[model samples]
Target: MSAHDQLLVVIDPVARRIDGESVRIAKDVLCAGAAAKICLPDGPEEFSRALTRRGGRRPVVVGDDHALLRAVAALYRGRELGDEPLSLVPVGSVASVELARSLGVPTGAVAAARTVLDGVARPLDLLADDSDGVVLGDLCIPAEAAAAASVLHPASVWDTCRSLVRTLVRPAPPAPAPRAHRLRVEADGVLLSDLDDPVEDVRVRAGDGAAEVTVTHPRHTGAEPLRTLAKVVTVSGPGFRYRADTLDVGPVRHRTWTLRPKGWALTLPPAGPPE
Candidate 1:
């Protein structure tokens, strides 16, 4: 058989715990269609080693979004993402495998396995951050919008003293009111919002050759959000956490993400005309 017909099936331990039946089904289908060497990795280290040791065989991940992300991240770090086309057999909770589904990978075990056996490799865009982070889908600032606006604030000396006094004297302290964040957002060197303007939300999505950015201001109730397409997006402000795909990252003061067009490839079912 050709190299393309040989697969290194990496089954994540989480997948085995979440849904063993689906994993079995996927394995059976892939093994029947192609020469598949199953690798039941116990943890992240084994998983990485399995992929690293795979020679001439296409890697097929059988797990959730985290599993898929891990595989892609490994290839990306090795600078082999473009050279290798990855396949997935998603076997986890709906929310856990949402990323794979969003990327056009079938959630069904049989369908996903069949796609791996006979499918087209499609080029996909991704966001690469300055901190060596990769975003396969979209990213949003203040991971939890409601909590972010209320919690992400720099406390002054007086504020800290007052809090301590309140904790010692008061039996119950009132919750802080939610407030807009003072962030500076820039898209491709074009300033979308400054620190003077309070922002309600910020989102960046990977597009064809650029990222689509949207910045919303709390003051502008009915006004449209500031939107633009840019190859680079930068957000600077007080230390804040953001959600990239399924991961919540950083209390970072500043972050920059660049769009890498067609940076990765995935094996997906053949495209059909829009219904």
Candidate 2:
């Protein structure tokens, strides 16, 4: 089979444990449509090995956002990300596959698998940090927002009742007001904010060919978020944590990210007609 017709489907362990049926369905669809080599990796080492030995076959991940991130990071570390377009069959909780949904990958098993076989490879932008870290989505300083957003739903009625009872028994304390960080923010080479002005939060989004930055101040509740766009962004402050994609990273004092225009590619279902 030609390279375009060959696929290396890497089924993540978490996906297998979470949804075996969807995994089976996705595998069936992909294998029926193309020459697919299934790789059920036992761990990270094996997972990286499968991608490394994929030869010319396109890589398809049957897992959640974390799995997709892993696949991309692997290719990126090997310096093959720009050339190897990835396809994903999102299989996990709704929250876990959010990144896949955001990227226009189909969430359903059959649809996503079929997409792997029939979709077009679209180039997408990404943020590369000074430490060689990659951000497939936006990054936020102070990971609290991301952490609070990822709370999983109660699995059972009893679990729900327990949560309700706990809430009533010891009503949660009020959330602390937003605090300001003394971070120095710079876009491209222009300074947007500095340590002198305490800022509430800073967010950087990887966009078309530039990073969209927003800085807000805690003191001005009604004030608009300070926004700008640039090819590069730098944030330096007293050690602080940040959320990149779905992962929490750093208590570092400083960091920089450069926007790489159309730096990576992913196979996605074709866009439908505009309404």
Candidate 3:
């Protein structure tokens, strides 16, 4: 590798937040070590434009979990993720990026940024849904609705103001607390869990060309969960939502995710477990 390797470092707004000292540290280390171009976009649209305008430069995201997901999704939509290996620098809220940390990204800002410059590119899998969405980690059904509020943003200030006005005009009931949902889960068309019994949880993980599906329910006497491996897993139930990584997506009665092997590559520590 040459000292002239150039990286397009896209810093998310959350990483550039006023209290984000860790993000600042990561930026400094990245710039000092390599020929890096930092793009600080104010919002999602700007982020997309910056990424689109990055010609012949590798992209390195500097943000928390959601930011990383968004970057991957943007590239995946353009059908460019497979050709380019992406790098990540985890910053912002610690609890928010458990996926990044668990994936072996150094929690420390400097170490993660250094990884962008010196680490090896590791092939990874992805869960691509029929709706054109991609999930890099576990996806769970029947997640808390309040979690959705935190991840989704209003389209504009007018939308925010309208929401506030509606809230004032009609005092809404308390949001429904998280609860189990009845679902019929099938792994490769084989029934895994029936809707007759309440499903406490449903998790789908991407593996090397397959998906690890886990279904959990209340046990009368320690009944074990139902688990299986499949290339595609479908969940159908009276409209249900799911949480993929940190983002919430759903309300559809039926959804399926196909496992993609070697979907993309990530810069990771040269010697260690995959993060």
Candidate 4:
């Protein structure tokens, strides 16, 4: 088949700059010099079903960051990434800066499509949860994020507030909280830290083959957050909550995760020179 043949484009209706005109421009550019067509979605569920029914065609997403996350989640839910490429053009206000920054997608929709048509696959990583939720980006454990968790299932005013306040609030300073969870973390048989004593939260990250786990004391204000690369990280606690990207995921008792390299690749806009 030709480069653009059998390509399926799915866009998020709510994504920024996603009106018909921008999408048509992407269709023109991505299919230039080849044969292709773009399909619009009524909503996320239809988009997911459309992807599942698409046979052998590569799937491309034309939406903002949340849309991209939804697409990725759909692929995982449908189990279609074993032999397909997932491309994206961030078309919403909250662009996939972190995803695009990592993948090198340009901001211009046309340029982003060019990357897709070129068919390059980079070794990417995905985080898989015990509940089968796979995250391609950051996970959060903010003090006030819990309020948002309660209304995660169906859209509610409380959940809406939880989502709104998180990105708006400045990262809280580190101040110890009165309550803490006693726990133990082991990395490849090495006992990294044993907080049988008491601590607020713990983080176990898997990037390389090794693991990095951190346990923090209970503070009213959380300290500077830690980002790391490890192969596998596990967490076991009494009762806790966390957020992955924009999705509120847990109150999980025991959860473990690791990076799935080359799990999926996205087409990104090019980057400008660093400051």
Candidate 5:
């Protein structure tokens, strides 16, 4: 079979969760255009297992942002993602997939699936933390990103992993009540914002081997967010949490993230506009 002839189609549970129509449409589009092997794993372990065994088949994910991110994270952990392009057909609530939309995946199930069958392969940057986690979209501080899996710190390992992946794949939780956090922000070791200045908000993304960082200052008057590019971004101060794509990141006093340039690849439509 040609490189794209046979496919490993991994469907995230969330897609078939509310109604099966979305997933069914995507599946029909893909199967009609290409020969594929579909795997509908029931849990994270099965999901991870399905991915590991994807020999030479290009993986086309049918789900939302979290499903895509989880697959990417799993691939990243295996260390075989070096130029292996991934295709996505986003399926879930609109808000749950803002990241996928921003990244240029077609929102319509048929559009996304057909694109996977015909789109050109492209590379994408990733923001990786000390923890074995990956972020595909912008991360914001002074935000409510409860560790997508953190709140699921349960009594058993099996329960923890299962519950964590489920919660992680769900829609973003509502923002918590407003509360100010005094945090120190540094880009490549240079202080950008200090504790004296209560952090209003901050955003970060990977680009050109460095992270493009933006920090906002609280104001009664209009003020633009501070922006810069650096290899490393460290946040420390009173405990804080950040929203990385669709999941929440921390409540710890310190966290550091680095840019991994073109560490992963994506499949997008030919002649598509930049994301």
Candidate 6:
């Protein structure tokens, strides 16, 4: 295969040093064989447009976890407009290590590029907020250190350190007792939990409903509390604050959020024929 048969690529400039290098190497490898056009985006907006306009062209990303998140954002922004599959070449430090490993991307740049060029297209699930902010992965809301989190990225080293400290060593003060809110929370019209009483370390999540919803409370001694997957979660506060994935938005008086699955066609290393 040659670069001409491959998809276009967009590399993030700020995606850690190693990621940039890996992207360069991946570009060379992808282009050498497929004749793919590589377009290094100056910013997120341009990348979104390129992805939207070039639906026939597979778009590959070269960056850290955030780079992939940016691409996901663009995909959601153009969800109704296009359905081109996405490819990624992970090039970051520890942050991208998990995503790369999970996706079966090789550690070596050339190997990862080969995977991208040889991968398959599959639909991936995503979570979306009311404001259209999408969470590609997990979302955590801490009760103890909410203040510190406001200052830094949710996944940042500082936040991680603080989380560890609060969880392991010196625990921070719990969030002020939950106040009475005039909102109702229901899942499939079934009452799961209500906030009339002051609650601490509350969590709500959506899942396959095969089992129970996982909830982790602050300063809990051993077991993390669990709840069932509800169709809806309604939150009402004077000003409610919630973290969706990596982005934060809200403080609205009353808002209802539901867990809905979104499909995204993604390009991965082509799968082998079934035995």
| Top TM-score model | 2
Model 1: residue 241 alpha-carbon error in angstroms: 0.7
User: Compared to the true structure, candidate 6 yields what TM-score?
Assistant: 0.69
For each candidate in turn, the TM-score is 0.85, 0.86, 0.81, 0.71, 0.81, 0.69
Q: Tens digits of per-residue lDDT for model 5 on 94-166?
A: 9877888888878888888888998988788888887767878788886433343345333788877887899
Tens-digit lDDT track for model 2 on 1-275?
78999999999999999899999999899889999999999988898789888999999989999998888888888888898788899999999988989988889899888888988999999998888888999799952332233467647988889978998999677665666788899999899889897788899999877889999877555777899999999999888788989988888999999998998999988872112
lDDT of 4 by residue, 1-275 (tens): 75445678777777524466667777788677355556777887887887787776778878766777787787787677656667776564434445555445665666677767764655466777666677666654433322222334676898788867985896864554345555554444455445464555555443443444555655554554333445666666665677776677667666667667667755433343112
Model 3: per-residue Cα lDDT at residue 270: 92
lDDT of 1 by residue, 167-270 (tens): 89977645544467789999989999899988778999998888999987774466678889999999999877889999888889999999999999999998
Clashes of each: 0, 0, 2, 19, 2, 17
lDDT of 5 at 251: 79
Candidate 3 lDDT over residue span 1-275, tens digit each: 45327889999997788337887888888888888899989999889778777888889998888888989888888888897788999886678878888777877788898888889888899999988799899898854443434466647989988978998999777765556678889889899887887777899999777889998875443669888899888899988989888888768899988888989898888986444
**lDDT of candidate 4?**
0.62
* After superposition, candidate 5 runs with Cα above 4 Å error: 143-178, 220-224, 273-275
Stretches of candidate 6 off by over 4 Å are 1-4, 16-19, 80-82, 103-107, 146-185, 202-212, 216-224, 231-234, 250-257, 260-262, 270-275
In order, the Cα lDDT scores of the candidates are: 0.88, 0.87, 0.83, 0.62, 0.82, 0.59
Superposed by TM-score, candidate 1 places the C-alpha of residue 171 at a distance from the truth, in angstroms, of 23
Stretches of model 4 off by over 4 angstroms after superposition:
3-5, 16-20, 94-97, 145-186, 189-197, 200-215, 218-229, 268-275
Better of 2 and 6 by lDDT: 2
lDDT of 1 at 263: 94
Q: What is the lDDT of candidate 5?
A: 0.82
* Model 3 alpha-carbon drift over 4 Å, by segment: 1-4, 18-20, 143-180, 273-275
